[model samples]
Target: MAKQSIAEIRKKEILSTFYEVAKVEGLENTSFAKIAQKLEIQPSLIVHYFKNRDELILALIQYNLDQYKQIFSIAHADDLSHQEHLNKVLDKLFSLDWNELYDDGVYYSCYTLIFRHPEIKGKFKDLHLELRSGLKTILEQCTKAGFLAIEDPATVAHQVYNLLDGTYYFVSMLDVKADQEKYLQQSKTLAKKLIGLH
Candidate 1:
């Protein structure tokens, strides 16, 4: 692997701090000074990397997309069959594990910008496309392995992705754990039905 440049390292550091601060204070409330204070660096250093708050926000959304991709990763275990691997992916998709990946408040706050910011909207579209593509690839593999019978992996992938998107958004608002689990299981069942699974 090639070594990371200083600029690359500093940018990631700034984005990571911004994410944490945003998670607590919200995207609208988080400022460059807050991020710089968290990093114990001068505000000018942050300006050196990001031209403006909008630029930093865009970079943070990309950072979020990178974090969201972790859900698709499967642990390579010799004992796990293709179907088992796909099952694991679906489980992760519907589970609260995503809550650990990023804050719902920060993500939804950024999502609202799609209406006002075309660039943010495009970045979000890319995030969705990449996620669906990953799911489609896994579904196709399962079909070829005879573990699934999806006729159109792309459509099924899109449906499942939508299911997860709606499920997570709704579940994020519930104050009760049981309610969240109930909806999550229901969504998973719906996803399995969509893919022709029992």
Candidate 2:
């Protein structure tokens, strides 16, 4: 693989630090100075990569989408059968592993941007569409492999994703582990039912 450019590496570093800082400080409260200080670099370095706070925020939203795509990555694992891969994808989708991938605070903060920023809203819509498309591809493969008999993989994919998304949002509000697990399992069950699985 070709080496990453210096600018690419620097921007990634800045975005990662910005995410961490935003998680702790809240996205509205985070600033370039805070991200730079966390990275132990000059604030101008961040500004050089991101022209303004809005630019940084937009980039961060994209970063959030990228992080979420990690959930479906197991679908490409070479060793697993299609059935096993789909199970793993479903399990990961409803589990707390997603919470570990990205901060809830930061995610919801960016989500709220859909109300005020058309660009952010468009990016978020793309993110959801891409996720649904990925899942649909996986379901289509399972159908072709005889592991599933989905007639409309695209519709099933959308339904499963909506189940996962809504479940996570509700689960985030509950403080008890047992309660969270109960809801997650319910969501997973519903998702399986949607996909014609038992």
Candidate 3:
């Protein structure tokens, strides 16, 4: 168990290094040697775990999706009010100083692979469905609590995801000062409108 734990830790560290390097250098330009150099480890170490570039990319995608799953844990499906419950969800979803969560470059680059690599499409499809269902569940709760009047939680969830994605893309590319706060506020306001809360 201890050996397995260490292997898992090393795998996570390697994947994280790859993610940073890929985002900075562009995924197409990234190589196992670059990730190894970034982590100051043997390139063979990465190859030992992941046979090649495509394998590593797939592993990183799974790792990122796993990290995203952690966000839902903050929701705490208990007796909390709809507003309170949704607040916890929204806070993680959109923060003024958020940089890490969106992972704009890395995420978008991986998304492009679904078209080129076809086999990877199911992974993304499942992830989006998971996110949509989770949001829809929370939205259903809000509707039951009488705080939100949304009739189609599924559609609203997709809209909210798109809003976040688009905002992340714009914020990452543009050099607008204080744009993060503006984007987050815009999302929050629009969410309220969509749910008919305000």
Candidate 4:
């Protein structure tokens, strides 16, 4: 295989370093210098990869969303009925068995950053809309398969997507065991009812 390009290697190193720093020190406290220190590289190296902190954050947001698409795509892929597939997706999302080590923290961090930084907030919102669009397509297919109600798939998809986003927001904020399970189960019930699967 040909050697990886310098740009590819630097991008990979930067993202990996960013995640490590964000995971340890809350994302709110992460900085380019911290990531540079983590990688034992000069801060200028990080700056070279990302023009500024805002650009770095945008890259991180894309990375986070791509990860979600990867997981959700595989988890929900099957030739089952719409309701059956929806049920499986919900179970995969709301299961408490692995809540302690869930990957939702990265998203929470990204959202929190956007909430604080209004200038880049639009980009974050765009990414969210993109996610909702994907979900809408899947839900529309389910409706055609007689899995969901005969309503606007886009509208219904937004409802389901918002509920999930809100639920995970709360989940990432609380103590993993405190009321996470209770809230997630309640979310599952509500999502089922909203999607008319119950």
> Which number leads on lDDT?
1
lDDT of model number 4? 0.74
Give per-residue CA lDDT, model 2, range 75-171, as digits (tens): 4589999888888988888898876788999989998988999998998899899989988999999999988999999999999888888898999
Each prediction's Cα lDDT score? 0.91, 0.90, 0.78, 0.74
> Which stretches in model 4 have alpha-carbon errors above 4 Å?
1-4, 75-78, 96-109, 112-119, 176-178
* TM-score of every prediction relative to native: 0.96, 0.95, 0.82, 0.81
lDDT of model 1 at residue 83?
A: 80
lDDT of 4 at 99: 44
Q: Which number leads on TM-score? A: 1
Summarize candidate 1's per-residue lDDT along 70-134 as a digit string, tens digits.
98777783468878888898888888886669888899999999999999999999999999999
Query: Candidate 1, overall lDDT?
Result: 0.91
Model 1: worst 10 consecutive residues (lDDT sum): 73-82
